[model samples]
Structures are given as C-alpha cells and as structure tokens.
Target: MFSTGQMIFAGLFVIAFATAIFITYQKDKKLHAKNYKGAVWVAVAFFVFIAILFAIKYTLKN
Candidate 1:
C-alpha cells in the first residue's frame, strides 16, 4: 500500500541501517570475539530447546 517514494525511502533507510551496523561491528570485531566466544553455543541450545518443546507438543497431539 505504500507509494513508490515511500518504498524507495524505506529501501534507502535499510541500506543505511545495515551499513551502519556493519561499520560498527567491524570496528568492534575483536572485542566481540573476545567477549562472546560462546554465543553460538547459546543460540544452538536455545533452538534445541524450542525444537524439543515443539516435538513434545506434536507427540501429545498425536
């Protein structure tokens, strides 16, 4: 439902936001690596928990 101009503006805003985030992350890459070493494992654990919950729900349904 948005006009063409609004769509273009939204696209530009997303580009700018992504660029800013990239620049910021690049600047702090070393700090993030040092401070967040186990973050990936945490994300995996969270997904596993969600999957287990869904599997239990499906089993109960059947």
Candidate 2:
C-alpha cells in the first residue's frame, strides 16, 4: 500500500514526464516527418505479413 506522500509523488512524476515527452515530440515533429516518410507503408506491410502468417497457421491447424 502506498502512503499519501508516495501517491502525490507518483502523480507529479507522471505529469512532469508526460509534459517532457510532449515538448520533445513537438520539437522533433518536422525532423520526424522528413525522416519517416515511408514509415506508414512499412507498418502496413508488417500487418499484411502477420495476417498471411496467421492464415497459414490456421490452414495447417485444420
């Protein structure tokens, strides 16, 4: 069980950590767009590959 002080510290820590991450992401937004232009297609391909693997497994299991 957490004490009142530990709970307060955890709440403050989460707020500070999230604020830091948001600020960092905003700072790098432009660089990320330029560097990761084709990233969506890569994600799509990964999903499709996984689907194919699942289909093969299903067929073999039956």
Candidate 3:
C-alpha cells in the first residue's frame, strides 16, 4: 500500500502537470490567435504524456 505522503505527492504532481498544460495552452492560444484546435490538442497530448509518465513511474515503483 502506498503511504499517505506518497499519495499526496502523486496528486500534487498530477495537479502541477495539469496546471502547466493549461498555462501552455493559454500562452499558445494568445500567441497564435487562430489555432485554438491545435492548442487544445497540444494540451491534451501534454496531459496524456504526463499521465503515461506517472503510470510508468508507479508501475516501476511497485
């Protein structure tokens, strides 16, 4: 079983990853001003990439 601290750390990592994606999407949207779809896909890909990383980390840890 994972410890409470480990769980919290994982949650924080996910949140930070999401926040970073959101910030990047916002910046790209503002900068490009016409490629909202591309920005959204980029954000989605980023989040998925982070999730995959987390999954791999957890799998290795266990």
Q: Which prediction has the highest TM-score against the true structure?
A: 2
Candidates in order have lDDT scores of 1.00, 1.00, 0.90
- Arranged by TM-score with the best first, the candidates are 2, 1, 3
Where model 3 places Cα greater than 4 Å from the true spot, the runs are 30-62
Predicted structure 1, TM vs. truth: 0.77
Over 4 Å off, model 2: none
Q: Which ten residues in a row have the lowest lDDT in candidate 3?
A: 29-38
lDDT of 2 at 47: 100
Instruction: Tell me how far the alpha carbon of residue 35 in candidate 2 is from the true structure, in angstroms, after superposition.
Output: 0.8
Total clashes in model 2, counting residue pairs 3 or more apart in sequence or in different chains: 0
Instruction: Please give each candidate's TM-score.
Output: 0.77, 0.91, 0.47
Tens digits of lDDT, candidate 3, 1-62: 99999999999999999999999988786567765546778999999999999999999999
Q: Residue by residue across 1-62, what tens digits does model 1's lDDT show?
A: 99999999999999999999999999999999999999999999999999999999999999
**RMSD each, Å:** 1.8, 0.8, 12.9
